[model samples]
Target: MRNVMILLLGLALCFLAACGANESTQGNNGSGEVEGQDEAEPAQNDLDYPQKPISMIVPFSAGGGTDATARALAAASEPYLGESIGIVNTTGGGGAVGMSEGINSTPDGHTITMVTVELTTLPHLGLAQFTYEDFKPVAQINFDPNVIAVPADSPYETIEDLVKDAKDNPGAIRVSNSGTGSIWHIAAASVEQATGAEFSHVPFEGSAPAITAALGNNVEAVSASPPEILSYVESGDLRPLAVLAEERSDALPDTPTFAELGIDATIVGCPRGIMVPKDTPDEIVEFLEEAFMKGAQEAEFVEYMETNGLGLVVGNAEEFGEVLAESHNFFAELIPQMDLN
Candidate 1:
């Protein structure tokens, strides 16, 4: 009986030891699985970022330069983004309404805005409560330089002729711009600063109307993009005197730049780019930058810009941010000096 009891106790002890070992192994396996799951969670989250469609807001009406560029970019980026990008035109307040909507978006990378050079000027003009700094830049798609254009039958055939006439008769040469505190207005002001000439700056609702005013001989000249006046120039209704760029545009190879004409303003006209709300996630911004950069380089997009006389300036987020900062600084000083505010 003593031997039987001893054997029973030994069996119980062995069983307990085996059970404890199995429990320890199971606990370790569970902990290992949990650690592995934790490691994968972040990567899964990263991949899940843009799980829906995106909305791109254009602040101008359809058929304008901003709208055209926005559409091109959205189309080109859709394939790479694995989702469709819908363009929404929220035109008003000189682009303030659309920009405000973009700024006030959820910052989840679904909502973005096509920003223009007006972004730098609108705040100074009291047209918007936000500036370029209010949003995070994604990429710069285009930079169409402002062109000094006049009626086809105008006597001012060149920049020199226009400046000479304007200098001789300060505030007499009527130069029409898109609006009072618009990018074209700043271009007109820069022309005056460079040549010591004064133009009777006439404000229109937009570039189309301003160009129309010049074409109808209501204004002596129109400061606008090459694309804005390309058809007219081709149709012999308008003559481009000079482009406000450091170099000549391929779209207008015959047209000289401001630098060629001894004018020093290198950057002018409307620079259109993409941006999201400032607090958007860095990962999302990076993804968008990559996608848009790829989109800007697409053959179809390049061909469209070239055919339309639009300047192609492809840049990533950091480079775009730098350009925006420079533009902001330039306009900040120029606006005050020109009394645009």
Candidate 2:
């Protein structure tokens, strides 16, 4: 009898202990927090998007300005990305081959392409199969503004006077550009559109030759980058009348923007920005945009740009995307009339 009673008591105690354990396991403190359970995890992929070294594709030669600036930007962005950035020069077909490689790359944050004005131009010219819409813009780091200059001894002292003369003598004033359908050519076209003038566009092999033609009076005026014509202006060879940019060029502080002169020169020149494949996740895209925009403001990048006379204009993803969209639309409409088939 006593043994039976003991067994019954032991079983009862075991049941009680199990009940207590169940209650404890399901219990919560007064703070409403559960006991002995792990908290929910965070959204992890964004924090760890770039899990390896990043490849930056520059669609130009290694020793050129694009490659140099791209390398500088990559070096500046490394600290923010927590991964080293490698610059790869993929040159062919005037930026088509390299850009194609980049846009067709894996849609991860590891591959970044440094895009230029050619992104919009090449497509319209039938030079490239892909358009700006194929990629997501991260940020713009540079904008080489176009400057309109005449020979020092020319009668047109101001941009207004230059336009008036061109309007008076339609097709008489020859304007030189880098080449047909080039960004500088677009700049010259912008000049004619803004002022309602007709210019005889003489496309040279490149900006140097175009500027040389202006210097030697082969053309009445030239549209080119600020750096290309700075020495000539300093030497009193070319007289800068206006700049086709959102603001005046640092190299020619005295020259006014087309906007400042009541003309809207909407064409952009040699704007360099970072981009990823369009299929890249939005989270990764945002993360990269933050990194590159931060890097563009770094002291190293700014100093390098200033020393090299490269134009430094930084903007976030939204702004850069807007620029690409605007340029794309403008070129789409304008190229049909350019007769570049």
Name the candidate that leads on lDDT. Answer: 1
- In candidate 1, what are the lDDT values of residues 1-341, reduced to their tens digit? 22112112222122223322332111223222311112111122355767799999987767667888889888877877878899998877667788899999999999999988788888877778898888999987776767889999999889899999999998889998877778888888888877788899987656777888998999999988888788898899999999876667666789998877777653555668999999998988988887786676666776777689876666668766876776677667657777442
Q: Which regions of candidate 1 deviate over 4 angstroms?
A: 1-52, 264-269
Q: List the residue pairs that clash in candidate 2.
A: none
What are the lDDT scores of the predictions, listed in order?
0.75, 0.73
For residues 1-341, write the lDDT of model 2, one tens digit per residue. Answer: 22112112222122223322333222333344434433222223445667889999987656444676798898877877878899987866667788899999999889999987778887888778999889998887776767889999999899999899899999899988766666777778877866788898987645666788999999999987776777788899999998876556677889988877878655456777899999998889888886776676666666776666666666677767776777677678776764331
Question: TM-scores, in order shown?
Answer: 0.79, 0.63
Q: After superposition, how far is residue 194 of candidate 1 from its true place, in Å?
A: 2.3
Name the candidate that leads on TM-score: 1
Q: What C-alpha lDDT does candidate 1 achieve relative to the native structure?
A: 0.75
